[model samples]
Target chain A: MTTTTTTATAPPTRPVVSRPQERPFGLIRHSLALGRRSLIKTLRTPEQLLDVTLQPIIFTLVYVYLLGGAVSGSTQDYVQFLLPAILVQTVLFGGMATGVNLNTDIGKGVFDRFRSLPIGRSAPLIGSVLGDLIRYVVATVSLLTTGFVLGFRVQTGFLSALLACVLTIVFAFCLSWIFVLVGMLVREPGGVQGIAFLVLFPLTFGTSMITPKETLPGWLQTWVEVNPVSHAMEASRALMVGGSAGTHIAWSLGFSVLVLAVFAPLAVRAYRRRT
Target chain B: MTFAFEAEGLVKRFGKTTALDGIDLAGRQGSVLGVLGPNGAGKTTAVRILATLLRPDAGRATVGGLDVVRQAGKVRRLIGLTGQYASVDEDLTGTENLVLIGQLLDLRRTDARARAKELLNDFGLAEAADRPAKTYSGGMRRRLDLAASLVGRPDVIYLDEPTTGLDPVKRDDVWTIIRSLVGDGVTVLLTTQYLEEADALADDISVIDHGKVIANGSPAELKRVVGGQTVLARPADPARLDDAAAVLAAVAGRPADSPTRGVVAVPVSGDAAFTEIVRRLADAGIAVTELSLRLPSLDEVFFTLTGRHTTEEAA
Candidate 1:
């Protein structure tokens, strides 16, 4: 068979097309661009906002009014105690959205488009985690605003409160890598949701996220005290309210780093193979 | 001659099923090499491998002379791919999808925007440029997907059954766009289970079956391999069918196969055979409602090579 390149060699029929030079930091740049796309998706589909915007409000109300007295003896006293836990729970839930959205994106072949592009291999996952951080920020703010309205105050001052929010969001971003791995491994979006809920339910509720670890039964207390959610709750509590912050902060940061070190590479590997 | 796309002895397996078994293909620069296959025949598998979307188990392939495995990043820069499913973001507007791809391709922000608008207009999607792709009809979604792939204007394109779910008119639109891309000297590797699509688009064709290439040639060359064409005549009077069949058989020096009522089809070697059959029918005093010479279609070529017909679903 005659190759068309023969003609080009002879007479050069077509103009020479110059290719775009690869950017030095194309991975980070592409990730930011994709992250912006994901954020716009959240904006256009406002129902995705419900978890951050509405979940905290309703959950805060339920904990303060219905279960507040039973847990902390009074609604006024419980708001300060319950607010940080609620924020942790909210960010945790927000973090799981990463896995679900990633799974759905894979199912719908969006990543196929990304995979074919000359972009970074891990850009989609990194971009997704970054975009979902917006959800975490919204949840943190909503929880704090609702808590303050319900008589909660940060005893440790404004900087501490800001630190607490940043710490929690960072921890949530790290925790999303675990769910990102789950999302990449799961067969379907629904399956990701199911597995995420299964893994998260016991970790969040059994910890000091709502009721104190001291009140739990002896055997369950062991698991609750060691749970990463409890450590995050304690870190945020230490920063937002007055407490010994160093140990809890260390543990939360340590857990975040460990989870990232483990799951981030695994998720990236799975993504490369699966896509 | 430098091949824009080339694959040799490519083998891929998913569990126990070999999706591709030692398949080989080559497409010259600025030409379309159609990989036509039935479902489970590894058309998509081959395209995916060449597109740098999958790894071949045992073969080496190259695009623009860059190794697909080792020089994948360079290969990606030189090729654009459109899969069977529309890969544009459903949540984003058509403009957003194209712009995002442009940005990912490392275009300047303003340049990307300009290119997106130009593509939207070229694809006849300018009116719906700001609307989310979810709202697009199947054809529009496909057009947007194709438009997204062109944002980089790569040297080679891999289209994996791009018109699978599109209506006839939409498929034709995609065909036109593909032709224009080739007209601009873009080499294309098109995979399709549809015989007619390959016939319409490909300069050269490879027929794959059960993960192997059963045949490879230009469309006319492949049709010749199946056999010669046939001359058919339908008698005006049903009672004269035998007479027309006898005349066709006498001139063509073969048995006339009557597949339908009042119609006789005789295999003819060339135009001379056609002329002799017409003269003989006229001498036999047979009045026919229709008379024509029909070349064997890709369908017949496939049937001759493989015992089974192509279907939408894979085995």
Candidate 2:
């Protein structure tokens, strides 16, 4: 047994090591590490893949077979028009998951853990968005492959088709910041889900995703014309099927940049304010 | 001597309600400062501010001579915080959670992995290291969370009611772990509703109520605030309690209180008081079943100081 010593002496305070000072670009390194964490989480729970994987395939196949003859005279013709719209819908839904996941993390005290760490303040927010890029890639490939199997050919060159896929993924990544902002302010995953969809559902459906804007009523067409989703879909459609895509691509990119500028800082600020 | 951490006139408000009203805290390096408070006493708020999780509305706080708000990143490097809830990622395995924290603290991948393994083994969680934290028992998850905080070997650790929901066995284990950390010379700021916990572990205790420090001292000092030592006895015969009480009163020089059947206790002042009571009881032919001279319980001290009952026992 140890002897009891009550000397009234204060405990010794050892010098703390100040090594491993935060290096330059430490934010990027920390974000990448957290991104890897999100990726591993996705891998473990493969069900998180269902929204990006199964939704695209189902939407492409069902739309082409069920509404093809009625809307565009042939399933082949309809697949050409519907594939990009389906991909856009898939990515939009994919973006909502970012908010839901972030809300869940905040509610679970995971964000508190991150905040107490020495990492950059913005790392967790940026990392989750970066990791979600994989979901977009998964959706894009599944939609394209299913359309190709259904006899939908990309008239544009492979380079243009690749650009179309990249455009949708980038747009979705930008939109995720908006959801991240919502996630930070909201307290529950279910609440985030409801609010995000309430904001997104009208935008996706009111646009020309399921039908041509010209075929819609005047009031609806007016909204569809200004809808960013329509611009993104038009950009993807023009790139995949041969057309002059410069204006649509510029509009899509410009809109995404504007959203990113407005939402990124707001999301990060909200995150910092939370405990 | 420089404090490991200190907060002066800290104030935080949520809407119209002030969560912290000029709360002040100071802790010496390598010493334990136990923050004892009932629910909604702003203990967590104070810890959060010191941990750099939230900015105070007014007043200044520092960790290791760095400002909490202006130098939050540096302060973060100096402190490890285990919040009131287990903050480990439920979706990640125990090993993964620790490694993630290690890497976030700027450790290389291999180093993070090695540290993660070492922490898991040290916390007796090697068997469940690969299992998702969601599957862990409450105690296991708390261990993993604490392990994550220690991965960076922070100079100061903030344990915010870490043992709140734990069973006694698990709580003892946590206490042992905390003692070892203190032995390694890490400064600790622990917040608990359990006064006994503070008495058992703290070098000094601060009792907070309504966002203000109501009492601050060592356990013995706080006990003295309530009263002096008490002599208690239970006679072998219920009828002999009166004789025992009279003997105790004569020796203690104060009237004894019979709190329950066959039990009499009275406040006593000196060491000779115990011997005097035993001699007097024997002379009076009072056979005692139980006898002891003990200080007042922390519960009594808390009630005497705050004039309110504790919501939970100091287990």
- List DockQ, one per candidate, in order: 0.45, 0.37
lDDT of 2 by residue, B184-273 (tens): 778899998876688789998888877888888887787566555778899999988788888888887767776557789876767788
For residue B290, what is the lDDT in candidate 2? 96
How many residue pairs clash per model?
Answer: 0, 0
Deviating ranges (above 4 Å) for candidate 1: A1-18, B227-297, B311-314
Off by over 4 Å in 2: A1-19, B228-298, B311-315
lDDT of 1 by residue, A120-174 (tens): 8999889989888889988888888898899998898999989989998888899
Judged by lDDT, which candidate is best? 1
Candidate 2: RMSD to truth? 5.8
lDDT of prediction 2: 0.84
TM-score of each: 0.88, 0.86
Model 2 Cα shift for residue A59 (angstroms): 3.2
